[model samples]
Target chain A: MIRIFKIALRNLLRYKRRTMLTSLLITLGIVLVILFSGLAGSFKAMMIGQITDSSLSQMQIHKKGYVSSIDTMPLNLTLDTNKYQKIEELLSSNTEILAWTPRIKLNAMLSNFTDTTNIRLNAINPEKEILVCPDVGSRMTFDKGREPGTLLNPGEVIIPEKLAKGMNLNIGDPIVLVANNKDGSVNGLNFKVAGVIESILGPQGKEGYMHIKDAQELLRMDEPEVIEIAIRLHNFDRLDKVYAAVSSKLTGFINKKGVPEFEIHTWDELSPFANIAIMIDFMTITMKIIMIAIVLISILNVMMMSVYERIREIGTMSAIGTSPSKIMSLFLAEGLLLGLISAIVGNIIGLGGIFILNIYKISFAFGRQENLLLSPTVNITELLWVSGIVLLIAIFASLQPAYKASRMEPVDALGHV
Target chain B: MALVQIENVSKIYQTGDVEVAALSDINLSIEKSAFVSFVGPSGSGKTTMLNMIGCLDMPTKGKILVDGKQVDTFNRKERAAFRGNVIGFIFQSFNLFPVLTAYENIEYPLVLIKNEPAEKRKDMILDVLDSVGMIDQKNKFPDQLSGGQKQRIAIARALVTQPKLVMADEPTANLDKQSSINVIRLMREMKDKFGTTFIFSTHDPRIMEEAEITHTLVDGKLT
Candidate 1:
């Protein structure tokens, strides 16, 4: 085996140009696969991490009919205090429930003295909301001496940072919020800017949040309406079970439409980017397949030429009593060696390219000024997978030519001119 | 004792429905340690006979026995073992592996047999190289060596395995007259020194003259 491998190695080296070209193709394929897949995976991970940890837990529960349409503004689900207490008690007892927060949401128009913009207002309980949405408190600041725990004075509100800048409103500036009440009455409330919050949840500066009690009185819901419930599980992987448990426990509840129902939506269902991530993953796989095909063809062509060029030598070995299996092993070894060397080369080049790009802080603008999407980073798992794939492809590509070499008749081979 | 016996052997080749009788009803025997040659014109079955004798090809009609083992009945592995242990081959074209140096070419057979220790293989290769007068050119590739030197290395490769029989198919066909004479003389000397049988298929008169026994093939039959 060792002897045959040595001979094969020497034979491959004889055609230096062909060998180098084949290896280069393999290296390029491996590098591209690693680069794109790595970027896609990292980008998806970053997005999910940001979304899940910053605001949305793995799952969310809302009034069943409320989510179907956005036209029902200030829509609220009324939970019986005793029933709500039981649900909270059940959640607290279930080890799988990591955290939970209830919120009241309203779609309203915010108007400064000069400009007005539409926004989604989330009225949250600061203490309970922090467990699920840790980014909320730290993300807000007030120029007027209002801190996170400050009770919401009758006419105080927190505006998003982007909204305040665009509308030319400062902390003490007065604004009007116009919203539709559950009774189909249009209502307007005047409030002072207690704080400014920065959030990527909605458009850069288009959304804000307030204390639940303040929003309830402003939206004219005589009875408190819990608009939505967000829950975090100890293991996100058990999202289906958590959703099932919550749905089973809260099936009959009077919502804004005066119906008895609630709805459950997983985080993946809420985020449209989850589908986009899946599509990108599929695209990465397609690209890898195409690259592997091209590399295999290139390597196969080179190996075929190599086999033909060494016909006489192969014949001599056969005549000297080398078995067909030994001959096959020799060629296979050569292909493996080529693959291994090319993988190393490709990885070095790919990683080097990524490193240079990252070191220079190279970023491409893919969105508006405030929310630019950065190029995805590479990770170790992608590198290892690409290397393994390249090695397999190299071995696969050499099969036909190696078999051809092994099956040649010694007499015919030696007789070649 | 006869080292090789060909019993009424005949070989037929089929090329697109055209039957060609390369060898017909040939019976011959060669004793151990004999330097024998098969001389014939082109297309007269010299190489075909050599191929059969070297276990590279099987006879179509009759049995071939090397050291009392029937060649036709041997399977692929058996044939390979027979070729590796019982016979060595030197080709007319000095078919040294182009990528290998003369030393490596000589070491090739030893590596294939896989029974010898590395030190023993080294000693044997060096000894064979010395015997063939190719020691100085051991590091040179086939393309770098002269025709005479290549043939000498081929001879060294053939003998390094210490086989019972060494088959040379027109071994001196590519060399000049002086080199040819030197190659034949070296084979004769090696045969005497090791008591190893030597067989040749050639049209070279020098080899025919130097051979202890000469068989002539005419129109695929010994005459």
Candidate 2:
């Protein structure tokens, strides 16, 4: 066996130029796959991070059927203070839950004295909201007199940039918000603008922020109520496990009809960007298929040519009593060795390419989100999987040629020119 | 005792619609330790006779017994085993693996067929290399050696396994007169040293004169 391998190695080394060219082609394919995997992986991760940290907060819990009519901001479907107390207890005890914030969602009329428009608002505790959605602060642009990167303060509003621009609002300018409560009564409240926030979805958004106490007062609620609770987990990779655990615990809360009163959703379920993430995964798979095809065709071509050129040699070996199986193994060994060596070189160069990319710190924007820096990274498992695929494809590609060489009749082969 | 017995053996090859006879009713016996040669012109049955005797191919009729075993009855795998354990072969081209050194080429039979231990295989290879008088050229590749040196290595390769018989087809066809004489003498010396039977095919009168017994073939028939 060892002698056969030695011969196989020497044979590959015999045609130095052909071997080097074929190996270079295989190595380049592997390197391209690794680089693409790193870039696509990093891009998908970065975009998910932005969507979750800025607005979605990884996962969310809401009253049953609330998300169906979420666009309507139905105040009648709010989870009252008692229901929230139960949820707060469950969330506090779960080790996976890093932070959670409840918000009062409502739609109301906003007037900048001369101009009036309908606006969607989230009323939150500034301190708690920051823990659940930290990147939300990065979107805020303070108007002159206020502190930068600050969450909404009591009696102050952070209007969307589009709203601010249309209404010509500025910091310290007083505004009125009017809305109809569940009781069919209309009420209004006054506040001053603190800052304008960039919309995470797109520029045409009409969403604004206010302190929770102000929302309760403006809506004439006797006690605190919330339409939704956004949660952040200690590890984002534990999303499914935590989501399942939280869902199981909340399943015990039943309404009069015996159905669960709450629904849970991960960030991907709530964001439109999930489609693009899936598409990135699709593209990565496509790239791997291309890499496999490149390796297959090149190895098959090289092995077939090797057999054709060495027909007389094959005859000599066969006539000297080398078994057909051993002859087959010799050719397979060549391909296996080629793939192994090429994969190693490819991995080294690919990882180095990723390292260089990291050093450059690539930054780009998606939708209304800006300055998203991609740190391309590939894990060991991914590299191993890619290498394993290349090696398997190489063997498969060498099979027909190896078999052909092994089965050739010595008399006929020796007679070949 | 007879090391190889060929009785009324014939070989017919089909080329599309035509059947061509390469050997016909070849009857011969090679004694143990004999130096034998089959001489014929181009398109004669010299090579087909060696092929049938070596178990590289089976005769279309009759029986071929090599070392008292019916080689004509053997399957492909069985024939290979028979060839490996009982017979050795030398080719006109010197047929040394181009990538291997003379030492490695000589070691090929012992390593590939016998799977001999490295320590013992080294002794067997070196012994043949020395008997062929090419021990000094053992480390040189085939291309690095002269025609005589390459043929000497090919003889060494054939004799390394200590088979009962070694068959060479046109063994001196590609060598010069001097190289041809040297290769024939080396084979004779290897046979004398190892007590192995040697049967070679050639049209060269110089190579034919060296064989202790010679059979002439004309157009697939013994003449």
For each candidate, what's the DockQ?
0.59, 0.78
CAPRI classification of candidate 1: medium
Candidate 2 on A284-353: residue-level lDDT in tens? 9999999999899988999999999999999988898988888899999888888888899999999999
Candidate 2 residues lying further than 4 Å off, grouped into runs, are A143-150, A202-206
TM-score of chain A of each: 0.78, 0.94
DockQ of 1: 0.59
Worst 10 residues of 2 chain A by lDDT: A198-207
Model 1: residue B131 alpha-carbon error in angstroms: 2.8
Q: Model 1: per-residue lDDT, tens digit, A1-417?
A: 677677867877888887888778878887787667656665666566556655565677665665666344436444435545656786787789888887777888888867888877877776777778655555577665555455335567888787888888888888998887767688888888888876654221235777777777877876666767778788866878877877776765565777656677777777666787789889898978887786678767777877887898788878888878777787888887787888899999888767665555534332222443445577787777777777788778889999999888788888987
